[model samples]
Target: MARKKSPTLTEAELRLMEVLWQRGEATVAEVVEALPKRLALAYSTVLTTMRILEQKGYVRHTEEGRAYVYHPLIDRNQARRSAVQYVVSRFFNNSPELLMLNILENEAIDADELERLKAMIKNAQEDGSEQL
Candidate 1:
């Protein structure tokens, strides 16, 4: 199988990956069941999406009786870090601090999150920060 290099997943694909990340492993029917009602996805839609993800090497399947159990091939944190890097590169002129600043300014981050953010920044500064 050919591995995709830095493939940007579609919204539906990301949603399926989200389910896989949350559940660790699930069947096609289980993924469809977990999808938000607003999506109005059919069972076939989930099945096809899972197959596509499997093809992309982001998801893998195992036989569990008659059903195929799917699990994420990548770690959740790594994907998030990849996505954050993608956004920073594509939208923020490859600057991570700008991305963090924009997020702090826009999103309704609560006090605890703000503290966590501060702690991260502090840790970064103390450790010479991560390279963008």
Candidate 2:
């Protein structure tokens, strides 16, 4: 069966989601405090963005006293997989191999990281063979 498509998050929404993902749940003031200082967003901006995230189904909230405690509806790994799938389809013609090749060619992957990647590829190959 095909997987259901998840809603895409904007950069601002993702920032708010990060706070919820890390903290498990938080109030609007908490989210604002968790954000990077460079972002310089006001509490109102964070509250508005989180409300938008709720509308987009990326978050859910419970009322705590007078504040809404928000949490991520989607986990980080799920969001990462969806985002990667989007990039693969849109930019790499649905070819993950092409995407890896581009990254390997252009990015400054260190020796340790390269070895780790190779080990992962080897393990994947072994797993694939076992499944066949």
Q: What would the TM-scores of all predictions be?
A: 0.71, 0.85
Candidate 1 residue pairs in clash (backbone atoms < 3 Å): none
Best TM-score among the predictions, by candidate number? 2
lDDT of 1 by residue, 7-50 (tens): 66778899999998999999999999998999999999899989
Per-residue alpha-carbon lDDT of candidate 2 for residues 2-121, written as tens digits (9 for 90 to 100): 855346777888888988999999999998888899999999999898888888788999998998999888999998988899899989999999999999999999999999999999
Q: How far does residue 77 in candidate 1 sit from its true spot (Å)? A: 1.6
RMSD of 2: 5.1
Residue 78 shift from truth in candidate 1, angstroms? 1.8
Q: Which sections of candidate 2 miss by over 4 Å?
A: 1-7
Q: What TM-score does model 1 achieve against the real structure? A: 0.71
